[model samples]
Target: MSITRRGFLGASLAAAMDGWQPAAAAGARVTLDQLQPGVYVARAHNAEVARANAGEVVPTLVHVTGAGVLVVDPGPQAAWGGALLGAIRALTPQPVRWVVNTHAHPENVLANAALARLRPRPVFLASAATAALMRQRCADCLARLQAQLGRAAMRGTTIVLPEPALQAGGWLHTGATAWQVQVHDNAHSASDTVLYAPQLRLLCAGGLAYQERVPEMQEASLQGWRQALRQLAALPADTVVATAPGTPAQTLVPTLAYLDALASGIGAALAAGCDASHAIDAVAAAPFRRWRHFHARHPLNVQRAWRQLEDLWMQGEPLA
Candidate 1:
């Protein structure tokens, strides 16, 4: 099925409204200098990239509270995490009292050691599944990355699991606010959480939500992801933040559409073929062709979605 010109324009418009500003066209590069007084934004770009790789620039933010400071998602390694910690210090002297991991991603959880060095160690928080994934898989995750990226580059970075895991079905309190954090399992990752700050009206979602690009997934549950967004829409948050090209203030639209499009494409493929590879290739080649660069990654998002859909179909589960 061909995407009509009108459909393409609609997708393009949605992408624009939701933070898919073209890097070349917008000529907008979010830097630390442009941050506001109460906000601190840090992007960790990979040290290896010659032209500055986007992987290294995972922007983490710190919001200053009257009582103390609240941090959202620490970077994957010490270099990025340490840089983020330093940026927060420059913004304020107040000890960070609360640390929230938007989801269980290595890039977001590898900097707890440096953050703990503060006078008062901040309490770490994540969704129940995220906490389990962190505790069970964090160290091995870092080790694997070190093996792949080389230990020298991954120096001073260890996976430190957060205490007090967020349980399913409700909000969790951190600092002065009862943050409406939801536990969304098997969506973007094994377990992803979306944080909704009523006071700030900000939604800090990890990989479950991304900005200006396709949603990267290792293990994705399409139905769960769609439902999670529906749940998030009911929250009081007006602004959505994620690990992306810019700060949390700018909403992420591409990630949402990426998931929706993947689900749609996969459903069509399953009806046409019995093999998962065929489904994956067809989906990746069709509606997702424009996102070819993203397809280079191993076990690409479509493949992951295909696997998840296979499990669901095998169990006779209903599709979204």
Candidate 2:
């Protein structure tokens, strides 16, 4: 039986509400930096997720509009979300009218439960695929995070799936401010959502772009991600909100360079008949070792790229 969006969200919410408890007070602090008149970004650490960071290693974006507020990627857990809400309140008294989850990753969406506490709860949205993935995986993702960060750190964190899936080419408007939603599938994740505000010349490329940090490849498509980066580069955006610290113009550069080197190295290894076991070591990691979490994430990226390339080769697709 096919499940409709409303039915799916209703069922998910019903289940989530059964054991729902008020989230513990926010322990992590979120500070917003104005990117544009109505746009702001709270940058996260470029290191790996752990108990110290409280899994708060993803940026949170806030856009204040004449009608209300719109938040993107609330945060890692309920406390982080609560901290984010407090940060937003410091800027404006406007109610948060919309909450957009750019993807299904727990670091980005689990905070939805905390944000739901807002008066006249904000409408939560994500791409259809993202919502589906959240339903399928967020419970495990939440549990895993709790284990990694400890129960006290992840207190009150729960899976909160977005509803009324957003679509590409759709425009989200709040009075004078507007955002053009663009969805790229099989790139950074199963589905990635990017927001472009023409008036502000800003692009919020969620998980598609990272800066000063090795890109995570657990659920990424190297080829597809490269294509998405190309598309983003061609945009007229003056600022790109990425995972690490860097100028907006240079936001996609580091990630693009890393991806290119990874793909080329893997392709060369395949051409040399190197097995997957040796392929990880064969990739040139010297250049990226200086990047944050390089030791932890680069080898995994190489393995993932090698597997993907092997599958493509089996289908007779030429490596680019």
Candidate 3:
């Protein structure tokens, strides 16, 4: 058969699309930055989540000690979990003894099975509220994640429950390493928790801190979130781990400041009677030009924050 120039090019383009691959996400390469002697944080990408690799946008924290290793928020799939395990192996031969799921969001807690079924299963932990929330939502979450990231990207993934879910301030000891569990409500998520290593003065704020990008408030409470930020600031930990770029402390202030600004900005917009749908243009205006994902995330943040703030205003409750 004879083919025209356009036909040949179209055929080749179709084949390329059929066999498409994301070069940037070829493998899960989370950089391990050593915070102190034995503490490391595999920082995730601060930009938007993509079909390329959903888990690459989430960070994981690794703590090593004589007993074993402990990991925090191990990404969103079996693949990410395997990458985390390999990262752990490169650091130490010790098995992963514990995993702390800081929240129920898939970005933070979906890689349980990757390391749970090792020589000795790793004990996954979270706040009791989070465990209950995960048990209720994880099956749906897995299906949704598979749909969003594709079955191939989510292959071998399973929802592993965080066992022995402890209350707030519970002490979880893994060998010589001890993590003080600090859980807060309605902050970053319905159940938000931070792990504090008192000795190392390291705090893993999980979703509460966004060092680079504008904060996403889909499941957040502005008032409660601000209170939680204050609590996090008061903690003595010098080392902070957030999901975004920049150092922990540098990220900390801006994250809080952005949230405060977001709340007030939205509040003013609401008071001025801007429609919820159109408030994004007003609230997320020029001043936030410096933050990343302003256009991508600001509209959603404005919409969600407006509803909550409106509810509070109508009920005669202060927009805490």
Candidate 4:
């Protein structure tokens, strides 16, 4: 069955009723007192860059283990990472045993160095493919950021590369809890990984799923992204925390709708002989605009969709 926007919203509402609030809402002002025992999200509150933006809010997670605490995707910048660690310390004195990077986005994985300052030197984990993608693509991404945001806004920007990369079916064990980290390469970005705790049926989906906004689809693999979400839907992840904070912890449908809309909208535009810019405008003016994050991400999503459609059509394949 096709997942629609309404269906996605309904899923989000259901998750809310199950005790998923904006974990990052508290991170807006100060480091939290303690991340509760259960799954809790950390939201980056950037007054200048992300205040007006609802989705740019980065998602980090804290999980308690009998051995020590595990931290996931420490915000983007050093300061944000420090604040996250501060928040974690407020929760437990147990050293951080692991620092997991969901992907290579500066706003997502650049805090490994700071996190390594811990007593145990947390093992920074990422997919081998993602680690390579960072080395090859990060310089270009940073250059683009410099061009777009200019030098002033690009201060303190560092590209982090992950070590001890995971292969397929990679597993990490901490205390009584175990995490299964898998690489769903060539999806949202060049490479992506999501953390799942099967025992709890909880998912830490980095960029694979976003909420409360449209996706920033630059460098996105539209078809691959769709396939990945399909695989995710097959999981029993009852609680989902996305890369964007305040996103309901278990809504799989919204991300599905956004991906499906982009694919279908691209197909419709192409069949109508619309140009890339025209397709972007048309999609944004119609179906895409209904999304809360549409204003910020529709243009990029359209660009990616058009490219993907163009490639597929040229190869004599129908858009899926």
The global C-alpha lDDT for each of the candidates, from Candidate 1 onward, is: 0.59, 0.78, 0.73, 0.64
- Misplaced by over 4 Å in model 4 are 1-36, 45-56, 137-160, 245-250, 269-278, 281-290
Clash pairs, candidate 2, are none
As a TM-score, model 4 comes out at 0.77
Expressed as tens digits, the lDDT of each residue in 87-177 for candidate 1 is 5545556667888876766657776655655455678887766787778888787877666655554666656678756666577665576
Error of 2 at 120 (Å): 1.2
Candidate 2 local lDDT, 1-320, one digit each (tens):
11111101123332333434334443567778777687787767766688888888887888889788899888888877766766666677677889998988888888897878655678999888888888899989999988998888788776777895689999878668778989999998999998888887788898888877789899899999998998888888888875653455566877887898887887888888888888777777787788887888888888889889899977988877
- Minimal lDDT window, size 10, model 1: 1-10
Of the two candidates 3 and 4, the one with more favorable lDDT, higher being better, is 3
TM-score each candidate.
Answer: 0.75, 0.88, 0.85, 0.77
lDDT of 4 at 159: 68
User: Model 4 over residues 115-179: C-alpha lDDT tens digits?
Assistant: 65455567877887777767777778666645654443344446666775676687878778878
Candidate 3 lDDT, 203-248, residue by residue in tens: 8888888865788888899888888888888878787887853455
* lDDT (Cα) of model 1: 0.59
User: How many Å off is the CA of 43 in candidate 1?
Assistant: 3.0
Query: For every candidate structure, what is the RMSD over all alpha carbons to the true structure, in angstroms?
Result: 12.0, 7.8, 10.0, 10.3
